[model samples]
Target: MAYLYNTGYSSGENYAFLEAKGLCSYIPLHGTYKGGPDGFKYHKADDCYTCPQGKVIPFKKVFFEKKNHTKKKEYRALKPVCVDCPIRSACLGKSAQEKKFTVTFYREGYERNNARVNSPRGSYMKGKGQSTVEPVLGTLTQFLGLRKINTIGIDQANKVMHLSAIAYNLKKYLKFTAKTVKSDTKAVCYVILNIKTLITLQIRLLTSS
Candidate 1:
């Protein structure tokens, strides 16, 4: 996914995640401040980015994006405020020309999306993970009738899990149509669908006739 990289924690985290994946990563620094000794350097440590005034750049602001309805965030440096800084001579002007403070921007949109997903809602969903969300587990224990494990060995246990998982999924496809697919909202249609589903399940289990 294309990202509007900034100078902040989210950018840092993303940089790490991408690095682990062995993907080439780059975060463009926005603003006019010339900073950080590692300017234009690929720093493994927050990419070694700094403000134009030699101060470490911090995550400055966050916003939203319209194209994907995601968050657009930016990271910037405050060293520009260094004109009156006590270390002004050592930070700005040609005398301190050896280096400058840096301003790192996280951009917007993509960063916000990242935060939203990592938020309470996102974390809860992540904590639940695939076992609860993707219907993979739902396909196993409930419909496949494979709640208990009776396999003999490691290989056998693995096989049971695979077969049961498949069977459970097959049952799910047969039981519900795509119209009643997953919805991330709570609405009247959702309520009615759930009620109908429960009633059908109850009748299938209890009726002797």
Candidate 2:
């Protein structure tokens, strides 16, 4: 199955999981996602990042962030390397330690997903979602009183959603039928007016003769 999601659902781990499950995902990266630091080159085989100053920042360890519980790989350059480097001030910005950074463990999956997101097929899928899915969702949330489900169980929520969809479809059908009837009424009025005009013209002609 294929899934199309917006930037809100974009994540390296999510991409990796979807790929592992043999599902296609077309999701745009969030605005804050930079993938990696600018001017840094990642070496896949070496499992390291090369700084702009040609120094290697090797992978140190994989750890989970306590606050967000995200798994990340830490890379750190040698302390001595940063201490004597000519651009140490510019690179580290008055820091007391070596160059250190953490990247998502699923960086490869992120790269692959990003590549697909920029492809033509992905663009088409995104456009299709905007035209077909997003508007309906907006209507449901904004107009159909589905912004929040007050029910207690999944079944109740599902029923509420079904009722909202039915209401939306019924509204659309009523609008279509209303327009059809309005046009039919105008047509009938137009024909009667023309007949009356013709009869009036005939009466005038006979009286004048």
lDDT of candidate 1 at residue 47, scale 0 to 100: 40
Q: Write down the RMSD of all candidates, one decimal each.
A: 16.6, 15.5
Provide TM-scores for the models. 0.24, 0.79
lDDT, candidate 1, 62-155, per-residue tens: 5554564444434444544444555557445655433332233332323444554556655554445444544665555676666788968766
TM-score of 1: 0.24
lDDT tens string, model 2, 39-73? Answer: 99999899988988888989999999999999899
Model 1 Cα RMSD, 1 decimal: 16.6
Return the TM-score for candidate 2, rounded to 2 decimals.
0.79
